[model samples]
Target: MTGSVPVHLEVDRGAVLDGDLVLPPEPRGVVAFAHGSGSSRHSPRNRAVARVLQEAGLGTLLFDLLTEDEERTDAVTAELRFDVPFLAGRLVAAVDRLGARPDTAGAPLGLFGASTGAAAALTAAAERPDAVRAVVSRGGRPDLAGQALGRVRPPVLLIVGGLDTEVLRLNEQAADALSAPCTLRVVPGAGHLFEEPGTLAEAATSARDFFLSTVPGPIGT
Candidate 1:
C-alpha cells in the first residue's frame, strides 16, 4: 500500500477512466487530482505534485476526466472542457467511487484542481460537503464555479501565479465570495501555466501544506 498503482474508475456506465493511485502506509488522508482542460492523468506537472503528496503520507489519485472518444471530440469542439456542471458531476462520481473502495474509505478526502478543473472541484465539494474535507486550486479560474462558490464549506487554498494577473484578480474575487475558510497565495514570476522555474513547486508545496492542515485525520488514530 505504499507505491503507485494503476486504477480504473468507472464514473458511470458510459465513462471509465484510467488513473494512477499512490498511497503511503496508513495514509492520513487521500487527495484526488483534477487536471486542467486538455490535460490528463499523465500531466507531468500534476504527477510531480502527486509525488510530493505521496511522500508526505497522503494517498493521491490522478485520473482522466474524459474518455478517449470524448477527449478527441473536446479537442475539436472545446465544449466539454468548460462545461463546469458536467465536470463537477464527474468529480462527484469519482469521489463516490473512492469512498466505496476499502483502501481509501477510511481516509478523509481532499481535492487538488488546476485550471478549469478547479471550478469542477469547488462545485463538487459543494455538492458533497460531507465527503470532501478540503480543496486546493492551482492557477485556476474559481470564478467559473459561480454560485457554487458560496456553498463550499471545506477550507480552500487558491494558488495563483502573480504574473497571471487576470486569474489572480478572479481568484481574489472568488476568495471574497467563498463562504468557507479560504487563502489566496500568489507565486511571483509565474504565468498561467506556472511554467516558470520553481513556480510549480511553490504552488505544489502550498497545496500540500494546505491539505495537511485542513484534511482531518481519524478521530482516534
Candidate 2:
C-alpha cells in the first residue's frame, strides 16, 4: 500500500474538486475513477478497487465528480447525477491535470467508471482518444454515451453482474455500438452492486487484469 496524497484539481474557474492520488513506485499506468450516481471519491467500493490496482503497481486518482453544493442540489433534484456531458467534462479535465503532473505524466491512462459514471468515462474517452489507453465499467450505464460510443478509440471492458439483467443487456448494446475493441464480462450470481460474497473481488480482479494487459509499460519507469 503506497501512501496516497490528497490533491485538489481546478476543473474550472472557482470550481475545485478533491481527490486522492496514489502512485505505486514505477506504476504501469494511471487510472482515474469516475464514481457512480450518488457516489464520490470516498466510495468504499471504488476505494477498494483502487487499493487493488495500487497494489498491482498502478497509479490511481479517485476524485469527486461534484462539489459539496452541487451534491446538496443533486440530492434533491437527482439531475446532476445523470448529467453525462457535464460529468465527462470534469473527467476530461482530471485526465488533463494528470497529464500535466510530473508524477503521472507520460503514463498511459485508463478509466474505471461505475453506473452513470461509466457513461461519462466513455464520453471522455471518445473526446480524448489520444490520452486514454483503456476503459473499464462496472454495472455501468454505458448506453448513455449514445453516438459518442462509435468514436471511442481505446479498448473497453464492461463488467456486469449476471443478476443485473437490465444493465447486462444495456452493456451488450453498448458493446455493439463501440467500434474499438470491447468486451463484456458478466459475473455470475452477482447483483447490481456486487454485494454478494466475493462478487466484488471478481470484478476487481477483472479490472486489474484488463488494465494490466491494455496499459503499456512497467511501473515507475
Candidate 3:
C-alpha cells in the first residue's frame, strides 16, 4: 500500500515545534495547521479538518505553537492568544522545515488556522510570500494582526459561522484589511467551530478548493 497513502509521520525537522504530521500518497500539496486559543496539535476539530484535507490529496502538519510549560502558563494568563509574533515565527520555521524535507520539497504549501492561529498564519504568509501559496481561517481572529494584514500576498479564505456574530464581524473587518485576493465565507448555523456537522465539511471543501486553485505550481528556487 505504498501509494495507498501514508497516514502519519514522526518527523523531527528541528522545526522548533512538535506535533503530528499526516501525509497522503504523493500529496498534491501541504497544509500546516495553526491551532486556536488554548488548542494544540491534538485538537480534535483541527484533526477533523486535517482528515478531510488529507483525503483531498494534501499533507498536513498539526503542531503546537507553544511548549508544554508555556501552554500551562498561557492557560492561566490567557495572553497566548495575543502572541501572534511568536506564533508566526514558529509557523514560518515549520514551513521552512517542511520545505527542507525530501518528501515535501516539491509540494506547494498552505496554512489552515483557527482563532489566534489565523493571525499568526497571516503574519507568516506575509513574511514568507514565496513559500506559502494559500491560507484558510476558521472562526479566526485575524484582526489581531493589526497593520500586518495588508502585507499578505497569498489568496486567503476566511470561514466564519454566520451565527457567531462577533466573529463574523471580526472576519469581515479583517477581510477588508487584507490586500490579497481573499473572501469571507459565512457558514450559516455553524457557530465558531462549525460544530454543526456538515458545516465543517463544507468549510473543509471550500478550503480544499481554494488551496488547490491557488497552489498549482512551484515556488522559485
Candidate 4:
C-alpha cells in the first residue's frame, strides 16, 4: 500500500537524475515534483503532498536535484540552489522518460514545485511546452525563474503563505510577468513551508484543483 517505482534519467549534461515513480492504482494524470533548494526527493512536506496526490489517482515523481557530493559541497555555501537551468534541464529529461511510459503515456503531465524548486520547474515548463501541462508552486520562488517566466505557456498556480509577506510580493510580480494563465493563492497565517497543520492540506487541495483543470485528460482513455 506504501511503496515506490524507481527510475533513473540521464540528463543531456551527462549527469543521472534519480527518482521515485509512484503511480495511483488507476491514475488520472502524472505530476513531476521539483524539490526546493537544500531539499530532495525525501522532503517530508513534498512527500506529504505526494501521498495526497497518489490518493487522488495521480502519479508522482520525486527526485534529488543534486548529487551526494554536490549536495555536500553546496550544503556549506548553498551555491547550487541557484542552478535553475541545470535543474530545469534535468526535469525536462525526466519528464520525457515518464511521459513516454505506458502507464503515463496518456495522462496529462503536471509539475508540482516547492521553494527554489518552483523556479526550476517553471523554467523547465517554458522550455518543454509540448510535455508540461499544468504547474503548481508551493511556498515557491517562481520569481527566480527569470526571463524563462515569459516563455511558460502552461497554466501556473502559485501558492504562498499569508505570513510569508516578502515572497507574496515576489510571487505577485512573477505572476504578472507570466503571460501564461496563472493564479496566486495565499494561505492565511502560514509561513514559507506551510508547516502549520491543515495549511499544507489546503495547499495540496488548491494544487489538485489546478492540475485537474489545466492538465489535458484521463490516461489513454
Instruction: Assess each prediction's global lDDT (C-alpha) against the native.
Output: 0.91, 0.94, 0.83, 0.87
Which sections of candidate 3 miss by over 4 Å?
1-16, 217-221
* Candidate 3 TM-score to native: 0.89
lDDT of 1 by residue, 48-106 (tens): 88888877878999999999999999999999999999998889998998889888886
Which window of 10 residues has the lowest lDDT sum in candidate 2?
A: 212-221
lDDT of residue 154 for candidate 4: 93
Off by over 4 Å in 2: 218-221
lDDT (0-100) at residue 73 of candidate 2? 94
lDDT of 3 by residue, 68-131 (tens): 7778899999876578987888788888878888877868999999999999999999999998
- C-alpha TM-score for every candidate: 0.96, 0.97, 0.89, 0.94
Give me the candidate number with maximum TM-score.
Answer: 2
lDDT of 1: 0.91
Which should have the higher lDDT, number 3 or number 4? 4
Model 4 C-alpha lDDT per residue in residues 1-221, reported as the tens digit of each score: 23797887776657777889898666778899999988899999999998888877788989888877778989998888788988787788888888777877767789999998999899989988988988999999999999999999999999999999999999999999998999999999899999888999999988887887777467776
Q: Output the number of the lDDT-best candidate.
A: 2
Candidate that beats the other on lDDT, 2 or 4, i.e. the better one: 2
Name the better of 1 and 4 by lDDT: 1
lDDT of 3: 0.83
TM-score ranking from best candidate downward: 2, 1, 4, 3
Q: Supply candidate 3's per-residue lDDT for 63.
A: 84
